[model samples]
Target: MRDLLGDQVLDLLLERSKDGKGGLRLTGEGSMLGELVKSVLERALEAELSSHLGYGKHDPAGHGTGNSRNGKIGKTVQTGVGPVRLAVPRDRAGTFEPVLVPKRAGRISGGLDDMIISLYAHGMSVRDIQHHLRQIYEVELSHEAISNITDAVLEEVRAWQARPLEAIYPVVFLDAIVVKVRDNHSVQAKPAYLAVGIDTDGEKHVLGIWLAKTPLDHATAGESSRFWSAVMTDLKNRGVRDILIACTDGLAGFEDAIHHAFPHTTVQTCVVHLIRNALRPVARRDRAAVAAELKKIYTAPSAEAAFDALADFTASDWGAKYPQAGRVFEAAWDRFTPFFAFSPAVRKLLYTTNGIESLNYQLRKVTKARGHFPGDDAVVKLLWLAIINIEDKRARERAAHKEKTGKIKNSPSTARLIEGQRTIGWREALIELDIAYPGRIR
Candidate 1:
C-alpha cells in the first residue's frame, strides 16, 4: 500500500472514484477500515488476555503458571460495520471475562440496541422499524428481534414503577384513559388508570399507571374499587405518606377508595366532568344556559353559597326544565364542592383533572397509531416511552428558557409556576386541614 501510494496510485484511485462511483467510502463491513477495526479489536482482546495471564503470547514466563493461554476461539460478532469474525482469546483457567464484549453478547457494538430503543420510543411499529433498518443500514431485523429489543424495557418499567416517591404531594390528579389490548385471544379496550402528582414545588410528576382488570369472582365495580385501593397502597408503600387532596373524574366508588386508603385526604370531583355529566340529560339548546348556571355554583364564594346557587337553579326555569341535570349535581354535592373549601388558587388546581388529562392526551397521541397492542406490557412500554419523550422535551425547553432569560429575574422558575398555583390559598387550606384532622399533615 505504501509503495502504491508513493507511485501516485492514491491520486489515480481518487480520480476513478470521482469520475463515476461517487466519493470515498470509509466504513462499513468488508471495507478496508472494517478489517482494520477487526484487527485492532482482536489485538486489544489479546492484550487484555495477556494482562490477565501476566504473560504475553508465547512468553517463557507462562510455562510454569497454572493458568496458560489456550487455543483461540473464533466467533462471529455483529458490529456496526456489519458482522466480523474475531479470534477471541481463551485461557486454560477459564476465569478470564472480557469486558469489551461479554461472552453472552451477540452484538459487538451497543449502537444497534440504542437505535432500536429510540425508534420504538418514537412510536414506530416493529414492521416499520424492520424496513427502516433495511433502508438505512442494509440490515434486516426480524419481527421477533425488534420485539425482543423493546421487551427489554419491561424490567426497567417495573423498577421505575416500584421506585420510591416523595413523602408528600400537595395535590394529585387521578384519571384513566382507554387503550386497546389483546385479552383472552381477542382485542378489547381496557382502562389504564394513572396518577399525576403535584409536589409542593408545583411541578407535575406521573406517579404511576395501572391496567384495570376485574379479578375473578369480583364484580367490575368491586374490582375497580380494589384496583384503586391497590394503587393507593402502592403509593403508600413507595413512601407517599400524605396527599393533601386528590382530584378525580368522580368514578363511582373511587371516593370511598380514597377515604379508605387515606382517611383524611380531601376528594374533589373534577368540575369539568361534573359539567359534562350535568349537560348530558339537558336539551341541546339549554346546555349553554345550564352550564352558565352550573358555573355559578362551582365558582361561588363558599360551599354554602354554592348550595344556595344550586337551590336557586333547581327552582329556576332552566333547572326546572332539566331536573335530572340538577339531580346529578345534588347526588355528589359534597365531593363536587370540596374545592369551595380551598382558596381560589387551590380551587384552580383541584377543580379539574386537566393536568392528568393533558398527560393522557400525549399518551394517546403515541398509542393511537396502533390498532391494538399485543399485550398489556406493550401498552405500558409505549406509554412510558411517550412520557419520557414529553418530559425530555419540556426539560429542554425549560433549560433553553432559563439560559435566555438568565435566572428569570422578573419572573419565576417552572417551580414557581407550580408553587404559585398550589401555594395560593395554601396557607389557609393547610390551616383548615390541620385543624380538621389533627396530625394528618405532620
Candidate 2:
C-alpha cells in the first residue's frame, strides 16, 4: 500500500483528519505515520466531545453558575456522552445556543456519564462506578456526580410509571428479579417485580416496577401481598381494563395476584423458567443431557409432541433424582401450554418471560452492587428509574411502527386506548386474593 500510495498522500490524509490536536507526523522508520498520529488526535478530541456535560438553571449536576456582566455562564453542547461542555457564549447576553460546535470552558462528553447511569442501572455502586470511571477513562468522577446522572432517570421513571396506560393489554408477561436495596433504614436485598405488556397494537411496554423485602416475604405471608397487588391496583387506577394473557416464572402467588387483579387474565408459566427449574434437579454431569432432552418438550412441533417428550422425560433415567424438577413442569403444564394457542411469532413472544426478564436482568445489573436500599421509597425510586432508562432501548428490539404523537413515546395518546374488558375467568380457576392493596391511582 505504501509502495502504491506515496507518504505525501498519507500526510495529506493526516492533515484533513486532524482537529488541531497534534497532527500526525510520519516517524523516522514508519511510513504514513502522520496520518496515524492525526487519527489518534482526532479520536481523543472525539472522546472529549462525546463527554460534554449539559447545564441549565435547573441543572441537577450542581454545577453552580458564575456571575458575568449579562448574568450568563458559558454555553456548551451536549453529545451522546453524559457530560456537557461550557462553551463561552459569544454574546455577553448569553443568548447564543450552539448546537454542535465547540464552546467556552469545553468539558469532556457526557457518554461516560451515560455509561455511569447504565452501570448504575446494572447495579454498580456509584462508588464502584466512580472508581470504574477513574480506571476506564481516568476521570475523577464524584459520587454525587454519578448519582446526579442516574437520578435524572427518576424524573423519567416517575413520568413513565405514572403515565396513563392502555385500557387493555392483549398479552402481558410478568417476572421479578431480586436486588438488594436499603429498606427500613437497613441495607437489604429485595425482589423487584417487572411487568411488561404487549398492547393490542403489538407494542411492548413495561407496565411498572414492584419491590419485595425478601422472596420468602413476598405476598404469601398474610402481612403484605408484596408489590404485585400494589402494581395491580396501579394498573386498575390507570385504567388497565383487560389483560388477556399473563406469563410468569411461577413465583409464589404471582399467578394468583394476576388472577385476582385482572380476574379474567389467562396466567401462563414461563416456558424458560420451567426449563431452568426442571434442569436444576438433574445431576451436574447429566444436567446438560437432561436439559437437551427436556428442550424437546417445549421446543416440540406441537403441545402433543411436547407432552410426548415430557412423558419421555418422566420415563428417562434422571426422572427419579430430578423428580421435583419434573413436578415444576407438571405444575406449570397448563400455563405452559398457552404458547401453543398462538401463531409462531406471537407464541414465541408469549411463551417465555423474555420480555420482562430481560428488563429484570438490566435491573439487576444496576442494583446488584448495592447490598440494599434505604427503604421502600428508595427502592421504588431506583427501580422505577432503572426501568425507564433500561426500557429506553426498547426501540432497538421493536420493529418500525407509525410514530405516535407524544413527547415521550410511553406517554398516553390524545385519543384513549382502552380495550375490551374480557375476563379470562381465572378467579374461578385460581385462588381469590382477599388482600386489598390501597394506593392512589395516578
Candidate 3:
C-alpha cells in the first residue's frame, strides 16, 4: 500500500500525517491530502531536525560557517512519503560518514514547507491541490498555508549559497533553469543556476543553487561572478585538489575562473549547448543537413576524424551557409578530442552531460507548479528534501548491483601478519606465526 500511493504521496504523508489503526491520518489538521501532508511533513521535519541539532549529525540549511563539526545524531527526513529518513546505525557510528546521502543544509532540512511549494511549482494549482486535499484526505488547505510552505526555504537558500564545499571533484557540470522569485520590492520569474557534480563513483551530487536575474536578458544580476568565486573557494577548502573535467552550457568568463583555480582540469562545452548555439546561425532549409553533419563530427572515431568529417560534410552540404558551425567546432576542438582516446565505455561517459542534466530535469519535475520561490531558502528546503530521494535511488542501485555480482571488492585481511604477531609453542596459530616470520617473534 505504501508503494501503491507512490513516493510523492507517501513523502507528503510522512511529513504531515501519522500512522494509525485506520490507515493514513493527518498529524495536525483535519485529515485531508494537502493539509495532512503539510502538517505531518512539517512535524516529522521538526523531529528529525531536532535530532540533528541535539546530537549534531548536521546543521540546518540556513546556518553556516561554510563548515562545521559533525555529530552522531541520525534522523529521518520525513518526506510526503513515509519517514524517508536515514537512521545511520549507531554501530557504524563515526566510522561511516556520508556527505551526499545526508542533506548538507540544516534550515532546508528543518521543515516541509518548501516540499509543499515545490509541488506547487510542479504545476499543482494552490486551490486545485487544496480542493484535492479536501476531497481525498478531507483536510482544508488555504493559499496562505501554501505560501507558508514556500516561505520556509528562504533561509536555507541563503545558507546554501555560503556553505563550504569539497576542494576537488572529478567532474562538475553547470547549467540553469528558470524559477520565479520575490525580492524586497517586486515579484518576478528568474533563472536559477544549478551546479551538479559527479564523484569518481558516478553518483551525482548537488554543489549549491543560485537565482538568476529575470527579464530573459543574459546580462542581469542573476549570474554573478562573485557567487561563482565563493563556490569555488568553498570547494577548495573542502579538500578538492583536482577537477579532471568541467561541463557547462556557456558562461562568460567561467572558463577563465576554472583555469585560474584548477589549471590542470579539462573543460568541455556541452555538445547540446554547442549544437543549439551553432544552429541559431544556420538557414532553416539547410538546418537538417547541418545538424546531421554536426552530429557526425561529435560521433567520429577520433577528433581528427571528426574534423575531417566536419569539413567534408560542410563542403558538400552546408557550404558557405554554415561556415560558423565549422569554426565553433574548431575553437572547442582540443578538449573535444579526448573522446578519441577513450574506449567506447569511457567515451559514452565523457561526451554528454547526462549526469548533471538529470538534476535540472528533476527540478523541473519537482517544481512544475510553483511560479516563483518566495526566496532562496524555499529553493534549498525543497532541493535538500529532494536530495534524500537521490540518495535513496543510489542506495537501491548499489545494493542491486552488489547482489548481481556475488562478491564484494576491497576487503582488508589480517592473515598476512597474524603469524608474525603471535608465538606458538605447539601446533597453534603462533607456530604459523613463527614459521611466517622466524626472527620477528618474541
Better of 1 and 2 by lDDT: 1
> Can you write out model 2's per-residue Cα lDDT over 328-425, one digit (the tens) per residue?
87877887886675445555666677656655666667666676665555666677656555445454222223243333233222211212212233
Off by over 4 Å in 3: 1-129, 141-167, 212-219, 280-288, 338-341, 387-442
The whole-model C-alpha lDDT of candidate 2 against the native structure comes to 0.58
- Flag the better candidate by lDDT, 1 or 3: 1
Q: lDDT values of the candidates?
A: 0.75, 0.58, 0.57
lDDT of 1 at 208: 88
Error of 2 at 50 (Å): 34
Candidate 3 lDDT by residue in tens digits, 335-355:
567556554545555566755
lDDT of 1 by residue, 142-261 (tens): 799779888888898999889898898777888888888877666778888888887755556778888876444533322267777878899999999888788888776777777887
Models 1 onward score TM values of: 0.76, 0.57, 0.56
lDDT value for model 3? 0.57
Model 3 TM-score (2 dp): 0.56
Alpha-carbon deviation at 152 in model 2, angstroms: 5.6
RMSD of 2: 12.8
Model 1, total clashes? 0
